[model samples]
Target: MNLSDRQSKLLFGGLVVGLTAVGVYLTVAAPDDEPERSKPRSVVTTGPTAPVAPPPGIATPVSPDSFDVYRLLPFSQQEFATAADLAQRFTAAYGTFRFDEEPRAYADRLAGMVTEQLGGELQRSAAAPGLQEERRAQQIVATGTATLDRVRDIENNSIIFLVTGKQQVTKAGKRSDDSKQYAVTVARDGGSLKVYAFEPADAGQEGDTG
Candidate 1:
């Protein structure tokens, strides 16, 4: 059937509170005295967001070709590679959004990479009428970076990761940035890693885009 039908099968609301909490971390800065004026774009699409060059010294997956090969030895080579890949994609999907477009379209673009439940939640959140108005009024668009900080637990069925990233907000043309760290958990679903839950990373607490 249709995508919405598929997602309806997975409907649940237990994580709404937690997800809203995560969204709260996306703080908006006070508008600058001379807010940079940005030309309004006519459309928005789901194509890959402009690539964000990872900052220096950020944690990343140990490359198979690098000297740090031993760092990835604890997990099976295949699982480590898959988890790393998922972490990156999840970051890209979750971190990128365009305020000029319809929210459902944005959520639709992210659907394939996430679980049905999450996809539905995203769609509902995006479809909220006030969301678009708020973005338009604020004249802001945000792009985020997701970096894999550490793999805390790996099991046959799931993986836990600590992720950190920068959320860059461009408002009325001027840009401001903030850093967020999260504990993420993902499970293997049909050979792909899909995020199950996420929370702010505390000084000690630990845990992807899809």
Candidate 2:
């Protein structure tokens, strides 16, 4: 071939080669350009939360030692001592007296003490006919023993105690005696202990016997 014809033929061959190279590069690089296969978007979800607990309530524990008797009676140490003293005085005052004596002074003292310790109920019970006969005929002696069985906190500044004891009566010349159980409910009134209730388990026992 002549020089011009040969040069043109060589240029055409070079162009074809370049076109093939570009096609191969595009096929290989197209897949790589596609957004990197996103590791399937992980969704981190948390579990359900736990429930919250409530606070506790106030607690009051009763004593088993004197629980039964204490429930029936409610008196404090000082009040019980005073009741016992008054009972002794009553015994001494009417120990050997005839039933006709009024027992006014003795009853007055008891009334006052009852008002202080047990309020009106005990005083009225003492004034009952049946109780009067027991006091006179049996020469009843009132003895008291005070015990702190248990202290229960009823409130921040208040407490209830389980208290229990005995009261007895005997005939003037007889050695045999009859006794009954008593209970006192005591509460803190301001700074001092007060008897909220005083109950005799056998107030009518004397009448029952006769």
Clashes of each: 5, 8
In terms of lDDT, the best-performing candidate is: 1
Superposed model 1: Cα runs more than 4 Å off: 1-75, 203-210
CA lDDT, candidate 1, residue 58: 69
lDDT at 54 for candidate 2? 46
Q: What's model 1's overall lDDT?
A: 0.72
Give the lowest summed-lDDT range of ten residues in model 2.
Answer: 90-99
Alpha-carbon TM-score of each model against the true structure: 0.56, 0.36
lDDT of 1 by residue, 133-156 (tens): 878988878888888889877766
What is each predicted model's overall lDDT from 0 to 1?
0.72, 0.49
Pull out the clashing pairs in model 1: 36-172, 90-209, 161-207, 162-207, 183-207
**Candidate 2, residues 78-121: lDDT per residue as tens digits?**
55455444433333332232334454544554443233545555
Q: lDDT (0-100) at residue 157 of candidate 1? A: 71
